[model samples]
Target chain A: MTTSLKKFRCAALSVVKHDYVARGMAAHPRFELVVVADDPGVPDWIHQRNQKFADEFKIPYVRDVERALKEFHVDVAIVSPEAERHVDLSVRSAKLGLHVVQDKPLTPSRAEADRLLSEIEKSGVRFMMWNRNGLPAVQHAQAEVAAGRIGRPRSVHIDFYFAKDAGPPRGARKTDEQQCGWLEHQIAAHVDGSDGGLGSKPMGELMIEGIYPLAYLRMLTGAEVRRVYAQTASAFHQLYVDHQVDDLAAVSLELDGGLTATIAVGRIGAASHPSGGEIKLHLLGDAGALVIAEGKPDVGVYYRGQPERESRQRRIAAENDFILADNFAQAIDSGGPTMLDARASHAIFCTVEAALESSRTGKAVTVRTF
Target chain B: MTSFFVHTADEAPWRDAARRLHQSRLVAAAGEAHAEVFDGALLTKPPAIRAALEAGRHVLVAAEPCLPRVELDSLQRAAKQRSLLFALFNPDRFLASRQLLRKQIDGPLGSLELLRSHRWENHIAPAPLGLSGSLVGEIEQAAWFYGRPVRSVFAMQPAGLNAVQVQLCFGPGMATIDYCDALQGTTLTGYRSLSLIGSRGSAQVDDHTNTQLAYVGGDGPTGLTVGEGVRHLAAMLDDFASAIAEQRDFSSTVTDALHTLDVVAALQKSLKTHEPVTLEPAEAVR
Candidate 1:
């Protein structure tokens, strides 16, 4: 690695059904997708998908993770596997002294997330949880807070709704039909690009998508959540309802220094919004406030014969991936923390865990600290 | 069709509203008025409202009185015993934009799914619009649009901050009100955004669309002029008089205001207890 642009070789670890992260990393000039690899004991569909992605990129597909990491001589591992396998792959790659960039919802288990955090810290490898924190609007909000425009943000509210249908409506399924399976529906959802929470176990909206808004809150306020009170409902998508997971949720967070925050997240069907549903931030500071629409700096396209689904298409400029990649590279070179380090990611996971518990017990739960 | 006496404090926030009500065509302002319109004086002289009701006169409050539940019940009883019309002037309900939004909701917007209202004001110091009053007003506005009783209320007010965030659950649908009044700015301007997401379509009324920025000589753009001059108080007064003549209910009756007050009380209790307050359906007596 040099002060100049140091191009790094990136291993595509388990790009099964999710190649967006791998492709995003390869988009940057500093990273090159070297190989795709996963455990040989995994399912056949996983290997097929990995092979397909590897073939598309003209890279070899290896069945063994360790063998591929050692053979390819990669400097970074872009783990795009399921949520359950995120911490395992990241820890393995970090133990091999490779910087890691993993997917969202870090891991489903708290102990696993903590292990990955500890392992990453021990390895001294830069870890960046691929997030929307690098989006243009997110960056703008960060700049506003850093510039002291809002003056010690007192409250932060984020509305993150993904206007995409997961499956049938909440009550549309017949009483005699079989309940939807998590991995099966997720694999099917890939056809329409709605498999954001792709995994074996069922995940609520807060677990699958809480990181974005939580990262925004952490970035702006620089405070850890102390307590959380949450309300959840399976208001949409029978798939989530069948799994006893929430498609819509609102979480109230009490952070350090009495800074309060709220997050309203939902996977409300596509008909609810014109484009990708409203992603907004409402920040209240001691001296001033800011209301930001994350979809700004975009061009809206509407014409005859436009598809009725997401008819008013908003084409947002694509720079989040590049910025995230550049940030990771910078952190690796300078030994600085990435935009969202492993510690912050663990805190967000704990907060989400607490929110889930609060929703269950119907009482404010103190966030687990470790 | 009745003469109304407007009572306002020296620097009442609703003084302009009182003046507008006094200048309405259907209602006349006189010294010996048969009806009494109470503005910000409700905070200081709440007994005047009860006195007007007790004296067999109709009572109209300019803005949200934020009366306690017990006092509201007393006022309700006094007005009911005398067969007097007790109306609260909810100017937001009568705004042209709000009316248009309602029409859209009933027409093309289809069944409402989500509603979000953001009201931010640049009050250097704690001015007229307090947090509780604004919270009540916003809850009323949300209920008016949702047309459903709030099932639960969860509110959060950051310590040492003049702001309140409330999430109201209406069974399947939900509405959120994020209001902050302690915004610090050189120019005293406000921001309001109301978005209604329904099954079919969406309708939004954002103050940003109506605001104009002038790039004067400074480090940044200086002047932000919001063009909003909807005379809602006059319309409210006209409706009040028409309701009285036709023997019908005003657009926002005392029952609706009481329901709003109930929700506001639940929200306050939630703020204190740090738990969501479940509310039974409001039993309106009109």
Candidate 2:
């Protein structure tokens, strides 16, 4: 296959980096990792790790975004910063006339997302979110839906449940000043200003972690979320002390076209068996139903009086971040619309924000559509 | 030695199995000379069951006993007081799939985290069985593996009584059983799938068309083949006869059946309340 290689640069703005994005872009046939711009807030250890990654990929690491933009002359910027910094990084990259490929939650809040979109629109630069669900299986499901395999979809069910983090970071000792610095930065990044710097509460986790399944449902059904009713609770995880965030949440959504969907997400204790996790998505249409049961154990090993054993395999479709990057390159080259553009990300953010509000108020909230 | 009698409704699914068991002398049918044997459908005919129990006849129910809680409880108490050998026939307990699952659970399989069983049948006919009726056997199978009483039950019948999904929470683990009766345009009898997930290993028994057992974890992927015919029914009848003649408890006794019934009852109640229903402790039943 002929390769249409494009120069790709990334702004490593978040302390918590996604290795998959970097690896995926590097592995893509049409993309070349040109430069990595490091933000000031990134810790020293993270910088070292980023440097190692850049060196291994034969790319230069620049501490300043302006320097990288001017020196690398890149075509697109893969902005994988923290949720709050997404807009700032995207707007800066857009100002340099660079198309954008950004991570999830477009921005921490809808207002920031609007500003970021306005910048990209003014710059006339192509933009896409790293929607991992835009992979083969989900796209195939979308195709099946379009082909009338299941007729008109009436309802959708999506669930994502995983084991909670074992515990807080071990052997972590920092001065009061250092701890305060980290806490302040995290609190500012939180859209709701509820971040205690420990971890995201259930709502935040749902917005970030649950967005994949939600995005998949949206892509498959092609329905806008109209209203949302959500219920959330800190069902388990006694290890968390006074953590107001919920450990379990269930959201019912009414999509624009009279399609209803339910999204359930939770951080429960690990399965006593070898099963890695449970992710189920079922779409029921007037004609028939499509059921996708992912992360189910295909093989099980049992030893008497011991935990069940099984191998956990990553969803092959989810590993297509590289494909998303490749799509970004193609969109830039051909001047066409990408699969998950800024408008789609905006709608996803609105639905997720609505669900968060509904959970907090115990009332169904209407999703704001622009 | 006590000889038991088998009585079933003419159209009962187990009638042929009962006849086979009687022919093998594992059980005796009630005839002129078998006056010591019982009369009555242990599940349907309560009046006849009372009469037979009063006559000191050993009785075996060739069907799932679904009686009102009070009546079933009273009968169980009366049977215990009179030392009557009463058995509820659930041949699933004797299926090769079930036996293989039990052996795996008891030996190689570690502590179970979850177990899921699905059974689909066509409900177009005028059969008295619905989703809950079809699930009695699966519930017993799960309980046997759990080795504990179900703590609670949450159930939903999304398609009315035609389809049901029940979630049973045991002490530390849980199980879910989904039963559907809406299968159409299928000549096959039904579909049955079982999986046992534990910490150390897991196994799945697919008893559709062929009895296929596959396991992983402890000793790796071990496959076992077993028959899917009358052998299970024969084994169940053997247990019943042994329980009667040896005066010993059987694998699936009236109490065990009652436990499953209680869970089903709780599940049914949960369906109405839209909330999980906690079951009475197993110890309280006796």
Candidate 3:
């Protein structure tokens, strides 16, 4: 019997928000891109971008999401839209019995996240949140823990910094200058491909990129965050200051099994680092400690005219995409859980929410269970 | 030459400092010395330090398991009455690498933006040396690097856990210190990493990176060396002698020691209260 490939649709604009997930899933032979779909209510620019992605993939473009889901009979719907639309699109696709691949920052709203999670559980559809846990460094760390190389984990510290410039520096604007519009600035940020939280809502660095590292903590320790004490600052960018959101944040977490962890995250401008940024994990166990630089397992390249921004190209690159896609496929084939399920994603979301609250209240906040 | 009477018990944990003091050529280590060095263990017996000051002997006390502000003030007053130098010994500042880092701060690194230090050990004593006290030296080191009073302090320690994480902001620069003594091991091994990020450059002193490993035949590579520790005591002794001979203030004064103690106290309070502590501007110290 010939094995049938699962058809998937790129559910939103690949041109605007992100196309990496779609391309990664396509790299796996078991999954095939069939159509590009979006809601008719989206702006014309989104439709244009969707159509461009469809043309690039040699697939059909449908403005009506429901019509596209019904007509194409796609097995998976990969959704990467504005931050707020993530839940709605995923909920729509899951209710149609299509497995969903949702982008990060899951959603800014708690209720919406619950709604999508409920739909996924009720419909018995698989859901995977795009994350960096599939990277080789992360995999090695997990394997070491599994092999009992470092014994039972006691504490972990992660430093996740994205060394990217975000427009003008803080204090560059005049005292009387008006705050920049969130939507306009985000759209403009897209020109440099630095818009992680792509929406009108001004989500901070913790909101946008916190999921990846939090997911790492969950994946490595298998313990949920119980409580968190956090501190935040608007240090690097005037945009964050204007929006009153945190561009830099540090959180100390208490977890089950007496595991203590801390995370320091910031979009510390490009000049701070040679590579894209430093993503390091420091884990202490019963027997010994391990320090893993996430950006490592890469080769350093130098030449006369190399862009100062791109210091070293990643080695064994994009394997995370392929690995995550394969894991999802295996989960689908074996009736197992996805690498990052909706509940886990929701837990991470709640952790970030608690951190933000901790920062605001100047106290430790208990993480809410989904 | 002036001399300091080494007044530590033979079995004190700071045998390295005592040995370095004995080996120093700058100042003779004698029984009838006009100055004295007090081990951190003697801090519990405040009268010994007071007696040394009352006898007109300058005194240097180890700044660990820091004394309460009141006790520190009493010692300061005793030294003032005798017109003798009263100093706190923070040997980390004397590490060759740390001296280079301090020099580089103004030489090539320019104004500092961030400082982070992580220390993990397995052999720390219990009680009085709780998570807060274990971080006093690091806090002093951070203040020394920034050369400014801490603007605010935030710290976290999970209940029944053997770790403390603190964030200190000193003007435009910020420092984070993580001290964990929860590791389980039979042997006494300590690992620390300090990184400084400045406007012009960044440097890190990571024991993990600095470890020289040899893979002859074992389950894993054996650590040949893990950076400096005992050797720094000699430099600290030399500096202390120079400070006494030159009649100049020591690298860290009693006032500086009090400030470090206050920071530790505030951190302990913040750990209990779950709130960031904002410090008032400190009074200038002579």
The better-scoring model by lDDT among 1 and 2 is 1
Going through the candidates in order, state the TM-score of chain A alone for each one.
Answer: 0.97, 0.81, 0.96
Fnat of model 1, as a fraction = 0.44
> Which window of ten consecutive residues has the lowest lDDT sum in model 2 chain B?
B32-41
Per-residue lDDT of B112-220 in model 1, one digit per residue for the tens?
7678888776653222323446556778888878777787888888877778888887776778788877556536677788888665556778875566777878787
Q: Given candidate 1, what's the lDDT at residue A238?
A: 88
Residues A54-93, model 1: lDDT tens digits: 9999999999999999999999999988789999999999
**What is the CA-based DockQ of model 1?**
0.46
Give the winner by TM-score: 1
- Residue-wise lDDT of candidate 3 within B1-286, one digit each (tens)? 5566665554233455546665343234534776787655434457877877787888877545366678778888777677688887666777888888888886577666678788876665433434444577788888888877776777765334466778886756777787877555424467788877665456678876787878988677776546676666666666677777788855346767777766777787787776678777874322
Q: What's the C-alpha lDDT at position B110 in model 3? A: 63
Order of all candidates by lDDT, from best down to worst? 1, 3, 2
Best by DockQ: 1
TM-score against native, each model: 0.90, 0.64, 0.88
Clashing pairs in 1: A287-B184
True contacts kept of each: 0.44, 0.03, 0.24
Instruction: Tell me the tens digit of each residue's lDDT in model 3 across A1-370.
Output: 1157543444442345777778778887777888888888888877887898889889988888888888887788888888999898888888888888888879999898788778889999899999999898999899998888777787788888887878787777899988788777877777667888788789999999999889899999899898887777777778888999977777788898767888878887777678877787888777767778787688878888888787675555537988898888888877789889999999988899999998788667899876
Interface RMSD of each: 2.3, 7.4, 3.3
